[model samples]
Target: MNGDWFIRGRDGRLSVYLPTDDAVLCRAERALGGSWEPPRRLGGEQRLRPGPAVGQGADRYTHLAAWRPTKPGEAGLVHSTHFRPHLAALDWTPIGHPGKTGDRTGPPAVAVDARGRAHVFVRNQAGGVSMRMQKEKGGWDPWRDLKGGDVQGELAAVTGQSGLVELYAATPAGILHWRQEKPAAVPTLEEAMDASVRPDTLYALPTSATDTTLFHTDDSGDLCAWRPGTKPTTVLPSAGPSRVSAVRCELDGHDCTLLAQRSASGRVAFAAYPTEQESAGAWWTESGPQLPADALVSLTVDEEDRVMAATLSPSTGRLLISRRKDEPGLALEAWREV
Candidate 1:
């Protein structure tokens, strides 16, 4: 599973998309401060590695993309959408594989554009990236190749504050980026980054129209933060080598960034600091009970502006959530399995 498992919709309701052993399941809040609906199976047989990738557009429709086995040892990508925040979603639509044979494609990475178009990016069988997006007129576009030879593991994409889509892929030497010069336009390959990034650990935090801060683990297992045209800086030296889940929230009348990850000791660790102020530093706090080795944590700010962290129960496959306490500092309420 990835950090996108928990998402807040435009209507202020939150939804959890879980990739189970047999199918993709979803549970959503009925109202603000209300109970969550029982898990609803969102059709897909057999889980693919790394779970489903989700994104939401300006229209508030949450888009989901996942890989499912089409046959023995073969898989294909499929998509679905929550057309309305508190309603049933549209049926899953098949998107197929990028190559003529084999499931060598990496996990799907989704980013919906400003015009409400969902664009899915994947590392193709050729060790390069390929993209397929939704057309404005209601349909799908053919897969287009965006070349990069050494992409490894998962891919990342973000629709920036400028309303243009930017992509990042981890490689053996560093990270490679692609940017859309205009809204709804093709993203051309930008300069390649020289920071040594750990596989499947890339997270893009959009700070400005043309600037995005990328967080990943370095060769030494320390957390590093880097923005385009800037040198990579070590933020949390001991932040365990795991996928970083981050969100921007208002704390004490100031804009702050919240990050969560599985620590080296199996506990979920959290940290916060003023946005883009990594040089000033942040104090990592280990919180919650120790999770399973395969557990992935997701962070999101709720309707009340409180930070929430969620992950699946390793034994029962149930949803467990922990919200920030209503007091000073970054303390959290007890974990609640809702």
Candidate 2:
């Protein structure tokens, strides 16, 4: 899980969802510098893993997907839920499982395409990928298998300019495989990339309507990015062993990408690509407060271009959410326990 569970409503308010002991916690930031409301439980008993995927559809409703164990020490399924942000309080609709019963991999990857349909991807126990889509009239379609090689890690998905969804997953041997799906079509695994170095975590960011950039950390602890026509470029050397999250966003009216990682040293660090000219050099790195030794970091950008990061502290068994300050520079403020 490496992305935010937050989505911005059409009215500009940001809502973030986190999973607590046996419930999903919901909190919202009021528009126009208003503070965040007190946390409210969304009402579910299954324990949720960090890295839940969330997207705002054209209908102005927020959709979310998360994985929870069916039983202690058993395989899990990916579940879908949604809410209308305009309502003061939310009752999450149980949208049912988007994956099969044996699906037991990482958190679901979700994205709302141009037509406002919600698409979700998860790994099945068979080491293949499964996909499900929201119908025009509202319910999800049956899970469709997107066959691939033995995928050992989570899948990264992003909607492309043409309304096609692209998926990326790394094989156990460190090779990356990608595929694209159009509306009402099955996806086929295309050619694979030769990434000899395996990454502990991987993230993908769509840089434009037609292009996307893949970011991952090599075994040498370097943060690297792979573009369409270029070789893998080391964005930051010595990033340390950690999961990396990235989002394509704007900074001062310019297109940029934000990268966040919790290094082996227990420090949460962030770097940004402000512009094309600054993409090759050392990013503006800002180190945040120390995290728990076993903290898992997930990063996301809200509708207001504010970067939100959630770290699950295993020591306290608490999930902490923090927002980057609105200043011009890439400075992150302190974390607030949710």
Candidate 3:
């Protein structure tokens, strides 16, 4: 399970920090002038993607992708985890089932293009990856498996005005991707109009990164920021004098602000830093109070700009929601039994 992490909204009225199972858990708080309130869960189940993916606009919308374990009488469900994804529409509308039993694919993630369409990227059974688009008008385009190596831990993001959906997939061949045809066709399920495979990137991956994200460092020796593109940005140099321990970043308007925690092994300490326009550090500078030792996750921010974080110690089952206190303001609120 992941602890808390942050992201800002289009209008920045809502700030979110998600901490949940293998899915994306969006916890939002409203920020008017200053003070903020405790965070609460968003609608529907978490994401089915390897991590989490979101699309925020007018009010704030998100996508939670995940892998569910199989229960009794379940056959194909074994290898394939139950995938449940929703678009933050007036009513949460589900996409489609990501994988089948024994399916070699990992999880599937979708990005909303400039045209209000959803694009899905997934790796099929034989270790091959593919892209699919679904239009707002109602219809899933065909799935075009991208050519090349085996893919896992898939992710994607649509460029602001360009309408290009940039895709990122962890692969044995290294990080992989493809540029969407600006407002690309809604991926079709039709037999015709299929996609041709294309290859990109050829770098070896660092094994320590079970999940990969863009990051940087600062003068205080704290690491922060991520210059995430529709594709993978350059990774931090593994070899460093200080030894980068952690990183954090959240979407802020047109860019991102990353934070990090760094210290010697067995040492407990924390620092904060911002990614210069150039994302100028080994990572993002983690700010605020220091987290308890043994916490396994990083920091997260919401639309209100308030930051909250959580982590479960392997030795103990504890869930913590610690957020920065700001000028309390009015916010859209909802609650239900989880």
Best by TM-score: 1
Best by lDDT: 1
What does candidate 3's lDDT look like per residue over 1-338, in tens digits? Answer: 21123334444433343445533333333443233344334444433323333432222334333344343422111011111212132323444333334432554555556555556565666675566566568766655766545554434333333454555444444344455443564332211111121222111111121222323222332232232233223334222223223324333322333333323342222333333343343332332233345444444455454554433232333334345444332111221111
Backbone clashes under 3 angstroms, per model: 0, 0, 50
Lowest lDDT block of 10, candidate 1: 42-51
Stretches of model 2 off by over 4 angstroms after superposition: 30-32, 43-60, 67-78, 85-107, 197-200, 228-230, 274-279, 296-328, 331-338
lDDT of 2 by residue, 48-122 (tens): 655566655555566567666565554454444455543543333344443444434655677666667777877
Provide the TM-score for each candidate, comma-separated. 0.93, 0.79, 0.52
Error of 2 at 232 (Å): 2.3
Worst window of 10 by summed lDDT in candidate 2:
89-98
Task: Compare candidates 1 and 2 on lDDT and give the better one.
Answer: 1
lDDT by residue (1-338, candidate 1, tens digit) is 54377888878888888776546778888997689988876643435544678887777678888887777878888888886556777777888788855764777889988898999898898888988888888888888898988899888888877778888889998989898888777788886988778898988877765688888888888888888778888988756767888888877777888888888888888888888989878978988777787677888888788998987764577677888889887889998878
- Residue 107 C-alpha lDDT in model 1: 77
**Cα lDDT for residue 280, model 3?**
44
